[model samples]
Target: MYVFIVALLAFVLITPAHAQVHVDIGIHLPGPPQLVVVPEVRAVQYAPAAPANIFFYSGQYWAFANGGWHVSTGYNGPWIVVTPQVVPRPLLFVPVNYYRIPPG
Candidate 1:
């Protein structure tokens, strides 16, 4: 009976340490907080659509897979390609559905 009690106590103490749920998500950083569960599935959509075409999904915003940015009136883009002459800026210059009014 004594051995049984000791075994039970040891198990209770050790089991909790291993009971943790290990979830893998992102790459490991060679530093603190080594392992982390990157439940962020959004970042995975980097190369989702065609570089020149785009479509909205899930709820968050999405952009075309185009090697370069584009400008359009709506999701169905292909309009005037935003250039330095169009706006003379980065994200601000674009005019596609991706281009939203600055919140200020």
Candidate 2:
């Protein structure tokens, strides 16, 4: 019985398990800033009350950060970005009033 158990253990160690598990977690983004555009700050027309350090508003793409609306020509971009960066990081995306424009 001891010999049988030892042999079984040896066989398990030597042979590769048929039931194998492998996992890959990844989201492939195109390499950094392939096409980089410096955006401009148009107006602080929304909820931030003050413009952001980075912002742009265009027909297709829109990114608001800092104090500007970065408008990209397309979804991926050839962005005409912009900003009015008085402060940093204080401006973040708000879910409740995303499209609500702030009054001066």
Candidate 3:
């Protein structure tokens, strides 16, 4: 009975940690992603909104909006914030364009 009680206590203590839900806060782009060409890098960037600096590169869509780096699988998204360290190397070099909203 003591062993069972200890196991039960352990389960109760550990269960909360496992039950935790990780929430990823991010922005959703309006409308479908449009293709944009970055001539300098010879890479195609997808702009979800014209004049808005959100882009899709490789497999993930990227957004330099809301003062942070955001990424998602689809154009319109439940985006998750990404640190500059994890941002793709190619995206780091994108020259400022008309769509890019400068981060203050």
User: How close to the true structure is residue 55 of candidate 2, measured as C-alpha lDDT?
Assistant: 28
Per-residue alpha-carbon lDDT of candidate 3 for residues 1-104, written as tens digits (9 for 90 to 100): 99999999998887765332323444444667677767765564756355556776787777777677877777766677767898888887877753457666
Ranking by lDDT: 3, 2, 1
User: What lDDT is reached at residue 18 by model 2?
Assistant: 56
**Model 2 CA lDDT for position 84:** 46
Q: Which is superior by TM-score, 2 or 3?
A: 3
Query: Which whole-number lDDT from 0 to 100 does residue 1 have in model 2?
Result: 100
Predicted candidate 2 versus true structure: per-residue lDDT over 1-88, tens digit per residue: 9999999999999998553332111212243222223322233222232222222333233445333445443433454444445222
Q: After superposition, how far is residue 76 of candidate 1 from its true place, in Å?
A: 1.4
Q: Write the per-residue lDDT of candidate 1 for residues 1-104, one digit (tens) a residue.
A: 99999999998887765333322222122322112111243222222222222323232222333333333333333233333343323323233433222222
Q: Which residue segments of model 2 deviate by more than 4 Å?
A: 1-58, 83-96, 99-104
Q: Any runs in candidate 1 off by more than 4 Å, and if so which?
A: 1-67, 85-104
C-alpha lDDT score of every prediction, in listed order: 0.33, 0.37, 0.68
Q: Which ten residues in a row have the lowest lDDT in candidate 3?
A: 18-27
